[model samples]
Target: MTELEYTTFGKTGLKVSKLGLGGAPLAGDFGITDEQEVQRMIHAAIDGGINFIDTAPLYGNGESERRIGQAIVDRRDRVVLATKAARSDMRYDYETTIRSVEMSLHRLQTDWIDILQIHDVESQPYELVVSETIPALEKLRQDGKIRFLGVTTRNLELLRKYMATEMFDSIQFYTRYMLLDHTAKDETIPLAKELNMGVINGSVLGMGILADAPAPFLREDIQADGLARMEQLAFLRKPGPKGLIEPAMRFSLGNPDVHVTLTGVSTLAALQTNMSYCDGNGLASEEVEKVYALFQEQPLFD
Candidate 1:
């Protein structure tokens, strides 16, 4: 196996693998997942030099964290584990925020989480998040339950709002930085760099659209627009199954502004394919310029 590259995780100072394992697929959300198989994949990820794992209680109602907890119990020290608060079932109040992390800790079977993020902030009122939710996370940090604070949202404007708060050490957004969009480069990513926050780029494959297995729930307009945009870049696809997969993964993995490019894979083969792009490779200069120019300041998903 090739050695994966590492980077300093923004202001947090922890070194993380450029390719982080995302826990959504392990929750069986994408398909039926075998617990033992999931454990093996997690171990494989650790063995392949992947030290960053991102999960959330919202992923299969805590199933992702539970499986990861079981897999990493003996090797917990080997990775930089991250999970989120604010499940879809609960309100994002201070009490709920505290309870969420507590439940996550129980499910993850860990005393401390490396990074605890406020999940999907775009769904709630910003004032509520500022006055109540963030304080709860702060309390968790002060109590030594979580090391750093972070936020995840697909809304660029809302993401910029959170970044301007300067309270978080990291920010995660998906789809915006992929081959189909690349809008994060317009502002959110640069702002994150200005804030010295770690940037975790998720859904580099556009929730499977780049791989020809587009998520069923994607808005018709997003799917249509993305597919249309993807069509113009037929030249970038490889010669294998869903040729866009490799380029999609490498597009983000090769980015200098992105600290961790998450590959949310359920199968070992998919993990290996994503890991293969960590060898310090990116698109050619001309190709990169073309992709960037294709959607300059154009938001794909509102």
Candidate 2:
């Protein structure tokens, strides 16, 4: 058996590795994509002991879901497939959110979803979440369109506020070593556990930053927020250690209470490399020390 570890999704009986396959740029779903190459990577992750995969209808316009679905159709029963709806990137709310889930199921070719989330919940205000959003989420859950309903966002305050209502079964938040901003390393996670919510950590690599990436693919100078991360951050000034992608991934997988960490695998090599970290103790203390030193010397992304 592969060395990957498993945990239940929240209090549910759904068992998934601490590391789950994230389908994003790999699926090329947003526009033009390499379906064949992404498929190979998907299988590699499955074979490497990743039983959890997270995707969304908005990712590459449902491209990631379709590719992930096709890759694991035969093995669908073996995974906890999670996808999100209710994107704030558009004027979407309750009705459109339901439509998004339906479309995602059609694309994923699955009759039921293990986890269905409210995508980009923090991008909007709390009123939106309490109003058209939460009600619709409740509707979907009642309709049994999804086995569990959760919210995916980085807003700890908002998340805490929602959790106070005791409505969701799970949550998706961001947690990583390089996290300087929008990180829940403080108390959100502990509270989540106390509240009995499944916690899935997203952007585990900081969008390839921990991959010691040359800056998450540096597309263009769009929003001021992104422009700030353009290569000048102290944490990224010096390149990360020469280790493959495994060390960072393995570290995230070790966090207790983390049901899964979603990593976007771009290639077959990327998937294999990440699985290398699945062995639990992929690095010795000194090796981990070297990795930490590397982080200390660079600019941290918040």
Candidate 3:
């Protein structure tokens, strides 16, 4: 077993594992509901030297946080836990945001959250996040309820707007640094580095599309297109020393702008496979370029 690599989470100065455990799977989002299995996966991640765990209240309606609380009994201090707060209407309101954080705290069973993010900032008005939502989070930080504040979104325009404010300690977005897409490398990642905010890259595998697996979470039309694109990159699945996952995982981890790569795993096997690629070694530069050339002219979605 290779040792997992660790990095400083941007300006926060918190050392996080290069590969962090995404909490959606624990909520049984990926068709996993066995409590014992979820606990096993969480413990396995920690035992494997993965300390950064990111969860959100929207995942399975707080089931993810509840399971996380149960999993990290005496080991809470060893993990850097992160969770999100989102209004039921998917809008940003100060009162609802505050209440959401309180509920997250109770479910996580933690006095202070390591990182508290505003979920899906793109769905709400930017002024609301900047004027009301962020100020509310600042109060929580001052009250010592959350150590750091951040935001998660996949919308490029919204991300650019939030980065300009420089109010967040970290930012989570889809890097999509795979054979099919590499949009984050364009401007979002560059701006993140310039502002010195932690970059947590999600959807590194294109939400399972890069793995050539069917992702029922996606809409039918999007799923169909993803499967077609997967076929285009079928050469990567050929018998070799490395398969599609290695190159896909390494592509995101290889980027200097990415501090942590967030991957959601429902089973221990998937978690172990990902950990193997976080051993501080990524694909050679030329290999990465070759993979990118295959789909440089093609965009995964509209």
Candidate 4:
């Protein structure tokens, strides 16, 4: 087991594990129907020394939180619980956000949430946050229901817009070590460090793009070309022995502002493999540089 190093979340200096287990896919992405197996994997992560575990209400519509609560029922104090609240149809106002957080606590079977994020609200109207959500989150903090408030969005613009407010302790977005892109390190990372907000990198494996090479998300009856890009990255990336995923995981963690990188991996073996990067034998500088160059060489054309 690796000795997980802790870092400051924002200026709080509240230590959190560098590698966090993303509790999204564990809900149903891998077709894990057995509760006992899911619980075992969650325990395996905890036993392996992961202090931070992140989940969301939208993940299987709250199934992820339920399973996580079950697994950590006995040792709730050991986990730094984080969850998000977001609804697409009508914007979730302050009261709804509060209700959602409380619901997540009930589902997670924990008294207090360590981190509560405004999930996916980066794309929504800004007034919704200032008018409704932030106030509610502040009230929750006052009431001792949550320890910290943050935002998770895939947009860099949204982060920039909210950065000036000092309303959030952390900002999350999709960042990875894959050859396909290094946008996080080049653009958003510097700003996050400048703002002193902990940058959490989700999709650290490009949503499992680099995790498996020979095998991929293939349908049973027919085929699709969704994997063409993945195969190209696997074939093109240089100076690394791992497939697109593992090397990328190491590369993302190499960033300084990145306090924790979320790997949405399921099962004990997969968790062990991801944690090996923090064991001090991760991707070499030369290897990461190669991937970075590839992204620089081929910026996505918008």
Instruction: Choose the strongest candidate by lDDT.
Output: 1
Q: Write the per-residue lDDT of candidate 3 for residues 1-302, one digit (tens) a residue.
A: 76999989989999999899998778877785788888999999998899999999888889999999989877999999999987446666888888899999999888999999888886788788888899889999999999998888877668888888888899997735556677667687888888999989887777777766656767788777766766766655636533577677887887777998987887888889899889888878877666666666455654
Cα lDDT of model 2 by residue, 129-229, tens digit: 77877787678778887888788766666777877787888888763333323246557778888987888887765555445553434444322333354
Measured on C-alpha atoms, candidate 4 has an lDDT of 0.73
What C-alpha RMSD separates each model from the true structure?
A: 1.1, 4.7, 2.1, 3.8
Please identify model 1 stretches exceeding 4 Å from their true place. none
Lowest summed lDDT over 10 consecutive residues: which window, candidate 3? 234-243
TM-score of each: 0.98, 0.81, 0.93, 0.87
Q: Where does candidate 4 have its weakest 10-residue lDDT segment?
A: 218-227
Q: Quick one: ranking by lDDT, best first?
A: 1, 3, 4, 2
Q: Any residue pairs clashing in model 4, and if so which?
A: 210-245
Worst 10 residues of 2 by lDDT: 229-238
Please, what are the lDDT tens digits per residue for candidate 4 over residues 1-302? Answer: 66766677777567778888898877885556566777887888888888889998888888999999989999888888888875554477977888898899899998899888888875568898888889998998999999888887766667777877888888887633244556667667787788788778887655444554322454422122324445645543545555565566667666657888887866777778788776534567776665566546232311
Candidate 2 off by > 4 Å: 29-33, 175-182, 216-241, 282-302
Candidate 3, overall lDDT?
0.82
